[model samples]
Target chain A: MNWEFILGRSLSSAIGSDAAVFALAAIGLNLHFGYTGLLNFGQVAFMALGAYGLSVTVATLGLSLWWGIPIGLALSVTLALLLGLPTLRLRADYLAIVTIAASEIVRFVARSVSMRGVTGGSFGLSGFADEFYAVNPIPGGSYGFGVVQFSARALWVIAVAWGLVAIISLMVYVLMHSPWGRVLRSIREDEDAARSLGKNVYSYKMQSLVLGGLFGTIGGFMYAISQQSVQPDTYSTPVTFYCYAIIILGGTARVLGPVLGSMIFWGLLSFTDTALRQAVGAGYIPTAIMDGTQVGQSRFVLLGLGLMLLMIFRPQGILGDRREIALDAH
Target chain B: MPTDTWVDGVTPEPGVAKPDPILVVDGVTRRFGGLKAVDVEHVEFQRGAITALIGPNGAGKTTFFNLLTGFDRPDAGTWTFDGRRMAGMAAHKVARIGMVRTFQLTKALSRLTVMENMKLGATKQKGESFARALLPPLWRKQERGIEDRAADLLARFKLDNKRDDFAGTLSGGQRKLLEMARALMVQPDIVMLDEPMAGVNPALTQSLLGHVKDLRTQGMSVLFVEHDMDVVRDISDWVVVMAEGKIISEGTPDHIGQDRKVIDAYLGASHDAPTTPEEEQRQLAEAEAALDAETAEREQLQP
Candidate 1:
């Protein structure tokens, strides 16, 4: 077995550009589910809007990339408002239902044949990242050390993605410590108690929804730019589930939880895939037992089992204090 | 006493007015489908006094409190707080206008620290604003002031030691203390407490009593619901008795203790004041006829 190749690929994937994207999305989920106790099952929808918003603005409306950023952010906020307006005042489960449905609707719309001219339908969109790379401050050359190196284009994207992740993490840390964050936590624990204290509970919930969606939108931007394309299937339901697994793997409510979570999640996933693929290729295992194509599906099964064990032994997750979880309270 | 007043065994009128009123509730009625939970004609709470609202089970005491504080809407009513019409105002708005309430089952925000719970009670906090929350300088001074006030309240309630602890860790009595302390953070003109002493232990009862009285000494109007007659007699300056959604009587502690309607509502109608001999005899004949009618109906159903 090629231990060197396996270790290098796993290490690189652990801190790759996709890790930054998942970090951003999970950080936003932390705000919704952790601090606010909102069950947002469709965080992927917000990411989709961010990607499609930027892509559509540039490819269809012919706007500049800079203009696309704000437009994408605005679209996310609007989506949050639409989702929150009806569900924020009701039971928390309603949000989970509405968000999941909303995300699915976004995917179907992007894939619809009638919208092919604008959205590129199932094929998605490209050629929108030229301006993004044109402004790249990185010199044209390979960067980094031994087996984890990136080409100039990859290096530029990783730099911007990781930088955004840092800024967003710092912002979340600051906001969660403030009095406004106190309100969110209070609402999470007891909505009536917060209401009795003269807090506008519905308004605070809407604010949290919009704020988290904005963070998710930034992550979506990174995702689209990293690929230099926007596709319908890329922002599917599994993406949200993956982000959730990352959060649960790291911890919830803790500011650095999702950031560390994404790194470890991606690393473990790649490691398992490589190990299983090698075992099957070397004929160490019979084809009837497991095949090469089955290796991809097996990694998720491993993740599912890992999540189950985490929930059973430590529902609060690593880096998360037991008291930090308000799941039952909600 | 006024014609509408009930002083010891005299039947009281439905609506009663008080001198120097601060909160005037009129024609406030709430119904749960066919059941009328509250249907008061008129009632006035005296300014800066500790008023006890006492009633048996299902007397709508809590429902009345909910309407006054805007926690629940009245089906038909017009109430005025400080002479401002406030029947349909939101609960938080009512709190913002210097009126607030506590719950029967304490809502202590169990996940929050006692200090955090107290800070939430403060109104118009600058740090609570979405934009200002990000900038520490903009609200740092105000937050410090709020924390100082919270610390002071925690100390007064003897919860200073538990300030950093989560409210869920608190005992029943401590949760009551926290709820009371949190309500006082509003510095309200009127504090409506729903059964503040319901689950309190005897040890903390005296201290909770002192806090209620202290609200009055500080010139804040205090209204509380209670079932413990001793507590009502010991602390209340005035008492309002309710039965089946209507105010049956209102008077001082001494007069309310002897009021026949109050006694009947609490001890059942068998404790009602004696009627005239001829009136009693006529009621006895009517009862025997009803008994015979019930027997005839029972005999028919037996087959």
Candidate 2:
């Protein structure tokens, strides 16, 4: 087992393009669940909308990628408003159910044969990222140290994706520090009390949902551009769950929780995969105990166990206060 | 023991009518199954005066407060605050109209800091809009002003030391103070408190009383429900007594304390009575006679 190679890849994956995307999505989730007490379990649906909206517009309809960006954002905002309109006024749990169901519906629609012409039906869409890459400022060849190198094109995507995440994170920090942000946290704490204080609770919740969805959509755009494709499978329920894991692992309400959690999650995942494959090849464990095929599934199992322990011991993630995590869902 | 004996004539005084009462509840009835939780008849809360709504357990004091504050809707009645009807309005709208209320149980935003809780109270600030919030100079100036106000309020409530601390970290008494201080951040014209002293420590009792008094001193009307007779007696400029969903008595603390009906209501006698057809007629007759007698008494006592 090459320890150096594993460590380098794991560390880079922890803070790489995928981490940036997940962190962005988790930031949106933090706004929905952490600040507004909204249980948005289908944030990936917004991501899918952004991805599909861009892919369909650019690849299928022959529109420019720049046009697709705004269209994708608009669709995401519209989806959020539609989901929040009827459900935000209801129970918090209802929002969770609706969001999860909505994401599944979106995934199904994307894969459905009825939309094959536009969505590429399960085969997915590619070639839409050319315009995005054409604007890349990086000159040529691979860069970075040891086995942790990335191509100029890959570096360009990582730079832009991470840059967007940082900008969005900064925006979120600013908003949360503002009086509106204070109202959002207050509503999460006690909506009735906030209402008694003249807050338009429903409006605030709607705004939070839309804003968070927009962030998730931005992550979707990055995910699409990085992969140079839009596939229905990419925006599955696990994607949302992964964002939740990142949020919980970092700290639900803390500004930096998602970013840190994403890095740790991807890092651990990469480390476990590398270590397990290396151990299998080295014959450290008998074939009866575990095989190469089973190693892929075991990482998630380990991650789940780790999460369970984290939740039991410290429900608030590493950076979050326990009191901050006890949401007034009622 | 009988319906006839229960009809003791007690007249209500039609004192000097102010220009306009801050809040008026007329025949508001909120029924829960067979029980009428609140059946408040005509009751007026004067502007800029501290009024205490006193009753024993299950006396409908909190229910009446809920109805007036838009937490719950009344089955049959109308309520007006500052010439605006607020009977069926949402709680947020009621608050927007300058009538905010605290809960019997503390409803502090636990996750939010003390300062954030106070800032939430100032929701109606013009800079809360998305466009306004995005502009630094515009929103920043408004935010700073709100923060200053919240800081001052925290100082007044003696919670300035814990401004940066989450509200959940505060003691029960401190949370109550934070709730009260947060309510004032909106600059409400009338503040309704439900059991402000219920869970407060004895040491903080005086401070809570002072805060309630300060509301009146600052020309804000107060309607509070309290189980502690001592607190009610000490802080209430006027007391309204409720029993079985009705405002049975209204007067100064001394007058209410001495009222036989008010005493019976508190002693739980009101709940023991039967609501038969014959008893209802008899009570109605007694009420008419009491109204006449009270009018006559007030006329005689007038200047």
Candidate 3:
């Protein structure tokens, strides 16, 4: 068992570019669920649209990479408005139902053979990330400290992804502390009360959806750029669920919650996977009881159990107020 | 500074419109399916006075309040506030034009701190703008001003000690006080309270009454719906009585208490005026025996 390799991989994942992507995505989810009390189960749809928007605009429409960025952002905002218009007036459960269904529909359409020309079907799309790397100023070489190392290309992507994360996090922090954030929190508590005070509840909800969706789109941009590819299966239901888990695990409604949550979640996930494989190889457990093939499945089971325990014991999470976790579905 | 003159008896009369009325309602009707929840024909509220709207259960008192505050739209009617047409306006728009209201069921924004809830009521807050919210310097001074104002209101309500506490943690009566304080934060010209004393403790009822009276003394007009007749008699400058979705009578509190129609609305149409003390006692005894028999039968059936 190579302990050095496992430890290095775990450490890298704890603060790596993937952590940045998940953190940004969870921040967006926090804005919806934590701040506005909007049950947006289709966050993955916004991400998918962002991923496809950029890839299709550049690869299929033959547009410049620069144009694809704004196109992706615009597409996400449009999608948010479309989702909000019909569902904002309905009960919160309706939004949850609509979002989950909408996300699945987006995934199915992306992978369908009929739209293969634009979506690239199940084979997915690649080769559109070269422009993103062309402007990288780093020289070709390996760079890092100790057991952790990364190629110049990987370093460039990580730098940009984490940089974007920091900027967006600061923006979220500032906005949440402002009066607009107070209104969002008020709506989460009771919309009728906010409405009575002359706050346009519907319009405020719509704004929250669009802003959070925009953050999800940025997360998508980081994800697609990091992978240098886009695939329908990559933006699945589990992705949104993971973002929800990250927010709850760290703390909902806290500024740095998603940042801390993503780091810890990815670190634990990777560490467990590595530990389980090592334990299996070293014959610590019998093959009849648990095989190497089941290592991936067992890790999630453990994670689910841990989450359940956390909810029972400390649903408010590390930094959240207990009052915030008692979500008013009305 | 108006005084209540107790009149022993007076005839039931329809509402009389006041001169220089601040709010004028004309034929506002709201129907909930087959039930006409509210059918107010004509009414006027005097400026800078506290008026009490009293009715029995299902008399459409609350529904009328909703229609006037724009919480619910009337099926047909027109109303004006301070010379502005306001029938079709939205609730928030109505609030922005200096009219604010509180719910019978207190809405204190439970998760928010008491001070934060108060700050939410302040109008023209610069930080409420998304673009301006991102720039702290633009709204920070105004935010501080709002906070100071909230502090003063909290002090006035004797809620300064709980300013940092979540609004949900407040006792029922304290939540009512918080709601009233929050409404005042809007600097509203007209404050509409729905059953402000309904669930308040007897101990806090006097304080609440004082606050309502203070609203009038501060030159703000108050329109409230209340079931407690004593509270109505104590604070109201004018009384409007409704029955079956119409204003059955409107006059001084003394006249409303003795109006034949008001009494009938409370006790049912079978009620008649007693001519002698012995006859009144005999009728009361008979009603008590009937009530006792009904209770005995209910108890026997329950077990």
Q: Local distance difference test, per candidate?
A: 0.88, 0.86, 0.89
Model 2 interface CAPRI class: acceptable
What is the DockQ score, from 0 to 1, of model 2?
0.41
User: Lowest lDDT 10-mer window, candidate 1 chain A?
Assistant: A321-330
Q: Candidate 3 clash total? A: 0
User: Candidate 2, residues B14-68: lDDT per residue as tens digits?
Assistant: 2223334788777789999999898876878777777788877898888888888
| Model 3 RMSD in angstroms | 3.0
Q: What tens-digit string does per-residue lDDT give for candidate 3 at B1-303? A: 354233223232564667557899999899999998888888888888888999999999989988888889999999999999998899889998999999999998988899999999998889998999999999999999999999999999999999998888888999999999999988999999999997999999999999999998899999999999999999998888888888888887888888888999988879677889999999999999999999999999995
RMSD of each candidate? 5.2, 10.6, 3.0
lDDT, model 2, position B149:
95
Considering the two chains of model 1, state its CAPRI-style docking category.
medium
Predicted model with the maximum TM-score: 3
Worst 10 residues of 2 chain B by lDDT: B1-10
DockQ of each: 0.50, 0.41, 0.63
TM-score rank order: 3, 1, 2
Which regions in candidate 1 have their CA more than 4 angstroms from the true location?
A325-330, B1-14, B267-303
Comparison by lDDT, 1 against 3, better one: 3
> For candidate 1, what is the interface RMSD?
2.2
